[model samples]
Target: MSTSTSADPRERILILGAAGRDFHDFNVLYRDEPRCEVVAFTATQIPDIDGRTYPPALAGPLYPHGIPIVDESGLESLIARERVDTVVLAYSDLAHTQVMHLASRVVAAGADFVVPGAHRTTLRSRRPVIAVTAVRTGVGKSQTTRHVATLVQSMGLRVVAVRHPMPYGDLAAQACQRFETPEDLVRHDCTIEEREEYEPHIDAGVVVYAGVDYGAILREAEAEADVVLWDGGNNDLPFYVPDLHIVLADPLRPGDEAAYHPGEANVRMADLVIIAKCDSATAEDIAAVEASVQALNPGAEVLRCDSPVTLDDPAAVTGRRVVVVEDGPTLTHGSMSFGAGVVGARDAGASAIVDPTPFAVGALADTYERYPNARGILPAMGYGQGQTRDLEATIRAMVDAGVVDAVVSGTPIDLTRVLTVDVPLVRARYSLREQAPGRLQAALRRALGR
Candidate 1:
């Protein structure tokens, strides 16, 4: 979309977001532009992210009185009351039809519906960048990112990982977050989902940066790196331009590569498309995904890989009925019924997977109703302390009533850190492994000009 010009009167703006993209757009494109005044930010898609101000410290000198972050439902009224002249849709993972519906609503409210393109929003880095994005959430983006980082390290280059924004707390403090140690997570008050992504990268001795302002985050990361790896979130595009744009496709959901919102864009833009979890998919499914990618982007290179699943404690899961606790976004908005945990439990000889619905309490129960596709697996939905406590209580109640013998968690971080479980809790872990022998190495060599 065309940015507001100097000739245009100073436009009052309302940003539509889910916390991540909203802040990035403002910081990179609108913060100091002088041609636009962002009246408010509207949040959705993640819980407990609304009702806070986008603190003035990060809002820059232009907005001395910070920007209000209101709930998305009040978009129309806010537009009318605040006299918002523009509404920028700055979030991702939305279908095209859904995007248009919002656009229609914005137009009806007499405001220009703006979606800043990649050029206006994506940052350019000093170091060579490699971005790992996916066709959708839960399609092995994390493992693929780790694989790229590991590859970069193997080449003896310092690589800093800059994750897509998940700034759900104090905007000022989170303007540029750095996570180098487990304690840093506590220092930043990272949510469970944030910990999942950050802790693993920290374990690898890689500094991970995120927060409201990506330009600031990038500068911090670039100072100590030979390469910057953009570990993307959801199915969102990268916040920086890359030397190598590696996108992932899931064979389990074959046609999604060409069908989903920005996923189709990723497939078309990718330098390489790695069809992940091929070993787990049927031959037909694998072929179907490859065919779709080939048709969508005829020149893109395709690699085969698998997110091989394993359990941290397989013995505890053997010969028992278990409850599967999956990644929150995966089972919820990601729309995956089972995650690595379920696969691990099944492989470890679990007799059955207990459906947690009957025993779920509070927000835990609400999750089941919300995602009917939850498929008996419990989603680990702890955006805040209340939700975290509810997760613990649900698991405790289930174990007490003997709903299952063990709990298999497919969540990335160790759940025991937050929940006290009476019975054995098995953790599921998965990592990216190339199916094609030297494809990844060759690609990396080309990317780094080795």
Candidate 2:
């Protein structure tokens, strides 16, 4: 068979094994391609291939028009008759070999064969790194660090949450022990007390020790974790260059001088700046911050977050939950790591918190006005990393905004450590399995009444 006529713009494309998630992705890719048109779908007549019904097949009577399903015997004739120019293999892993064989045949038959780009793999022993810093203290950086850790763990990757050096607090030390894996330390039996012997910060009520050797903690954590979330203290720069720098700022801090100043050194390093305490800031205040941040870092993206937003809340999340994961120069600088407690809560069928501000609940109210039934909200607070005054203000803001919710966190500090803060705390060790996408999705679906 041969084509008697031809069109200049539309190229006939043959899609093979178009009956699964791979096909769905292809559909999305080709939906708006003006130069390529998928004309047919071909597959073998085996039980594995033929027995399964096409799940959510592409919509018909659309741009691609009707997709003719063809078998192996009919493939050559169909291609000739339809004047197909290219063949695309859309089979999943189990059927990859079959698709390859079919593509070989298509190429031999005088048609171009297109395979998707090879999956890029990084051979580095180190994992990706992401630095989590705040423009100042009390912007819920600790909480957000935990959340990112959970997210990474969900991706089937190990993670370590690192904090800047500080005066060691027993609670912080104990929290570190809880997150430390047996292999992270020289010996599994090494107690926090023994671990802190070489470092005096343990008794200072600030620094905690998670298992891995302190000298190589960052490197080891980077290698073990798919992503490492480094919690940088005020005016501290993480040792490694970050692929992405996240700066959390609390807009409600009392003095304007304490707020994020565009001229400040820290703000200049941020790839993304999130203004916390959105509920406490007036419109004028928000605008001022935005203008200042833009002036300081023209390339950086700024986001505003309020606390206590829920799935049922109609006034939350006007924007899509835009998340980007990448691997770069140093594994530690590229990805964000989430904590184990957050993962456990999501896996245990609890709603995930997504706040990063004191007035997160109020910001959520505004978000609901734009997007009703947002899946989750990022709340900001509960981890110890701010001045007493700032912490009190954050707690008060949450209360004023009616943001009451339990939170999960992990620290190198002692497990016995407890905070008498206003909100409930559910502390646990960190792990990778609890934050899986399916688990999180299911939890959100249940929360949003899906």
Q: What are the lDDT figures for the candidates, one per model?
A: 0.87, 0.43
Which residue ranges in model 2 land beyond 4 Å of their true spot?
1-125, 167-178, 181-214, 254-263, 309-450
Q: Where's the lowest-lDDT run of ten residues in candidate 2?
A: 322-331
Instruction: State the local distance difference test value for candidate 2.
Output: 0.43
Residue-by-residue lDDT tens digits, candidate 2, 188-260? 2333323322122223222223421223445445544555556654423343456666766545542231332
Report the number of backbone clashes for model 2. 60
How well does candidate 1 match the true structure in TM-score terms?
Answer: 0.96
lDDT of 1 at 243: 90
Q: In each prediction, how many residue pairs overlap at the backbone (N, C-alpha, C within less than 3 A)?
A: 0, 60
lDDT of 1 by residue, 351-385 (tens): 88998888888888888877889858988887887
